[model samples]
Target chain A: MATSEDGDFLPLTPVAFDILLSLLGGEAHGYAIMRSVQERTGAEASLHAGTLYRALARLVETGWIEELERAGSDESDERRRYYRVTGVGRRVARAEALRLENQLGAARAHGLLGRA
Target chain B: MSHRRRAVTERLYRALLLTYPEQFRERHGDEMTRLFLEKGVDARRRNGRAGAFVHWLSGATDALRNGVGERWNESRQSRREAGTPTANARRTNERGGGGMDSVLKDLKYASRTLLQNRGFSVVAIVTIALGIGANTAIFSVVRAVLLQPLPYEDPQELVLLWGELRNRGITHFPTSPPDFVDFRDRADALEDLAGVSTFQASLTGDGDPVQVDVGSVTPNLFSMLGIEPVLGRNFVEEDGLPNPQGALPGQPGVLPGIVILSHALWQQRYAAAPDVIGRSIEIGGGPAEIVGVMPPGFELLMPPTAALTPNVDLWTAARLDYVNSPRNNVVLRPVGRLREGATVEQLQAQVDLIAADLMIDNPIKATAGYRLRVENFAADVTAHVRPVLLALFGAVVFVLLIACANVSNLLLVRASGRDREFAVRAALGGTRSRLIRQMLIESGLLAAVGALLGIALASGGITLLLGFQPADLPRHRNRSHRWTRPSVHGRIRYRRGCDFRNGSRDPDVQVRTRRRIEGSGRPLHEPVPKADQERGRRCGGRVVARPADRVRLDGAELRGTEQRAAWIRFRRSPYVQRRPSVRPLPAGHRSSGFQS
Candidate 1:
């Protein structure tokens, strides 16, 4: 984890932050991103199948992730679609991570982290 | 392939097939199945359990995608076709490529609106349903009764002949036997002349003696009406000749026992006996041989539903003899078929001249004078009930109209209430026509619900009408004759044909009774029968007063027509012709004589 100095930053929802962080390490499919997020958090987060697909579809529609063709497979296998984060997705994710770091840094400076 | 493994694969295929649209199943289901199986085998090889599940999901998604893609292509094609100015193309066609999307959006909106105001929607639907149901039920009755044509071949040419007894102001009198003979023999314009009369007789054989209506007709009746028996033969021409029980070549009036049964009678009583021919049945204390069965629903024509009804279960042939002199007996309804090209006007003219000549020959009988007219037989039968049905139809239509108006008013109010939502949508770029269409869709949904409810109500009403039928109704006679309660059976058993079903009855001959003076048997010019005098005494009684010895008075009229003619000689008459008597009445019990 990295920390920032400035306290002034934007607010982000936990799920959105987690999803963005999961895509940080590498490009991934929807299920792979979900699996990555679950491993790092060490916590179970339940998501309905429709909800998961809807979120991925929205993300793609909003230009955050782009669809990429599979390298080599049976022509009929559409479920093995690959996705990669866009420039806009990377910027949003970076900005969210920096804002969380800044809040953590302020808490440490105020001696509220370990002292509490 | 093992049976278990094949079954598993088949189950997965069925699950995946659901993701495809219905149209795909109809068009290319087999081809798509082959493609799915080919891919499934490869997927199973590469993947374990989890991988197999993923492959299944992929297959399902492919099917869905194909459905969506096909829809998109069809819409595009439709848009291209619409661009061409086809004859049936909508003017100002707002439904371009995105018509499906817009209609779907409207449906969604309408559903949502209905859900929000569930109470209003229910009330509107119920109201409209009741209104529509009543209209449908009554209209069906009207169609069956009034609108349907007479079930005869070339019924348009058939006509009814009425005899006018001019002296008694009796029009539409049943033709006397002598008059009928004259008409049948003298008339050249008509192809055939026939007569019919109604009588009651007890049906004795094969069951307990039960009363049944009997329609006696001249032997040539069926030939004149242009109808033939469905199972056997009709009356032959020689049967009506002057000889009694005369046997013509290929004809049997030998035993004087030839009659046909109606379809309903045959089905119920005879159990559809195929060998009913030459069977003996007792009617009116006489045995008649059953020759044939009339077609089902043939009762739609004569008396008792076209004489095909079991109202009169048996018909006997009327034999005409020239020596029988019965004038003005007025018992038989005469009908005839005109010659190929003769019109009613021409026939009526000839009939009028004949009638005038007959009147000139007999001065006393024709003194009062009457007029002659020709009417269609079908019209005469249905005239009684036609007006009532037409009135009911008019009333039902009013109810439907009121329902429509009420629904429109409710919609108008709902639209005004949702004005704010509409304005927001308009600001967001929805057109006025789109808003109107959405509102119409909501109304249509309400209408559909109402229609279903109305159907239920109508079915119930029909049951009620059928349950409470009257006895004299042409349809509910000996055939299928089951009795419940008298009230339930009082609805005038409707003929299966629409006319009697709608509560219409045809007027038969009118009976007029008068008394004749003694010594000469000649009718006298006298005042109408007094109600008080006729009520106490039997009809045809004379009131005589004895003052010095005996004063005789004549009672020349009877009140009740069906009552047998009788003579009553009163010992003393109450009223004096010219008398001056002085009697003073008390104040409270005063007599007012000639107040004017």
Candidate 2:
């Protein structure tokens, strides 16, 4: 069940949703996230420095993602900050995915998905 | 593949990164730059220059779009977190705190009051307009001609060496070949010396006959100026030797009759063909081969009495031998570059000793009152106009201050009439600071509008001034068209970093563009313009060499036109303006004037 607090953020914008989706894979730096997101939805609509960092800032604010300390898995790890999705982020992503699924269901019932 | 060109691309990107707000830039700037460099190098390696060009074309847009977006968002976010602005005035209507909040309210209220007093507002704005407009016009000329540093290497170290006849009261007379040789050989403190004589001649053969200014220069003149030919080789020392009669073109000890084309003549006649180097041309109706082409905007500036025109269309080496030339035939106007840690005063002392020796040795010099005077090249060039410019600058400054004071007096008078409103607001619990702030905001609004109007008028005035650029005005060849902004922003930026009284920054809320290209990623060996070399030092490394690369890259300041156009687009961007706006005025309240 989506708590009322979490429900306020239900209909996440495409960029916020994509950022949360990219973080589903363990942890990554800014460039890595940009690369992964660009791979998913081509470089034509790119996540540049300003946009990527702003989305990251907003995500950190919403507790959807967290900045992490290097756990020393790679001993030579430099100042490249790594970020990962949080528990609340996972819940919000699940809620958003379900909402999208419901919309797809309605589309299917209305023969809008080329399945009629 | 030119790695230097690649480095220029990176340095430019780093300068562009200034568009982001400081905090956000601090968090991710280095990482972003590293990523950009890595991608740029990769793109270049994989697909060559065009691929890299395409990549950066998108990359530039991405950076500008996102950077401006982030800036707008940051301002809104900070305002929200800090407290209510005027939009939320009703929320804090009774409370007398919130610095920025109150300031905005005062601005809004002050604007309303000014609108109410139409006649007074018009009078005050017009007064300020005359003051600011005239000041701006003069400042443009002053900044262009006087303040603009001479386009050369270490211009301050460069000085004009002149022959002064103290007995006759002529200070800037030309020097003879023998005198020049003496100065050149004996003046150890002087780094290098070069002499030039200019004369008008008919240049024929390319298309039509045209009169051209020819500079008969010594061989060392090109090296002394530190300017290389944009194409072909500079004149060798042997080139200055006389071309004897019936001399073979390539025979040993025979001089080649050659001349270097000024950039203007080359473009005008030859259509800027690169292959014109070895082509035969006629100068002063005598056959000469074109050897080289000077860089665009290169000219020799000398004192007026030197009688050398600033624009020398053709440069031919002087064939007159310096060692054996006639002593009394004074023709060459000599200019010298100073060695490090040498001053004109120090040079004067040393030259006095040499002159005394010359007087003792040569009876002619003693009889003729031949003495030497060293002057800073720029100062000597502006000798006739410097005092006049200074006087004019002083007058404009006084006029502006008086206008400000006049407006200040008018404001006081207007404030006196608003006493009942002030009393009522005070009785209703308005703080003293609020009343004062309201009055301050009113005057500020009037001054701001006046300045804007003044900028418009000044631009018109500047066009007129530049149109008639008085014949005697020094450095009229300064190429001012490229540097002219002709707007209010131009003056404000001209004043920046000029406040010597305060070597410190304001402790108020910081603005965007705080870190202006103290490049963490300075592109090594990148080619920048001569104008940008001083600014390039701020980015670190000796990157201003490689004159072969004419690709000029001026940093963020040059982007004013695009930046402003993009600023309007960003301001209107829906994502940037998503936050609630300042509440709109009620139907009649906007024009109703402030009611007690």
Best model number under DockQ: 2
- Each candidate: chain B TM-score: 0.59, 0.64
Interface RMSD (Å) of candidate 2:
2.0
Misplaced by over 4 Å in model 1 are A1-116, B1-105, B185-189, B204-210, B241-254, B300-310, B322-325, B340-342, B361-365, B368-371, B463-596
Tell me the interface RMSD of model 1, in angstroms. Answer: 10.7
Stretches > 4 Å off in candidate 2: A1-116, B1-106, B245-254, B360-362, B467-469, B477-596
Writing each residue's lDDT as its tens digit, candidate 1 over B277-342 gives: 778777766656777877776653443333333355656676555347456576667777888887
lDDT of 2 by residue, A8-111 (tens): 79899888888899999878887788788888997633666556777888899888999996642566447577899999998898789888999999999999
Per-prediction DockQ, in order? 0.03, 0.30
Candidate 1 DockQ vs. native:
0.03
Chain A, model 2: TM: 0.85
Error of 1 at B63 (Å): 13
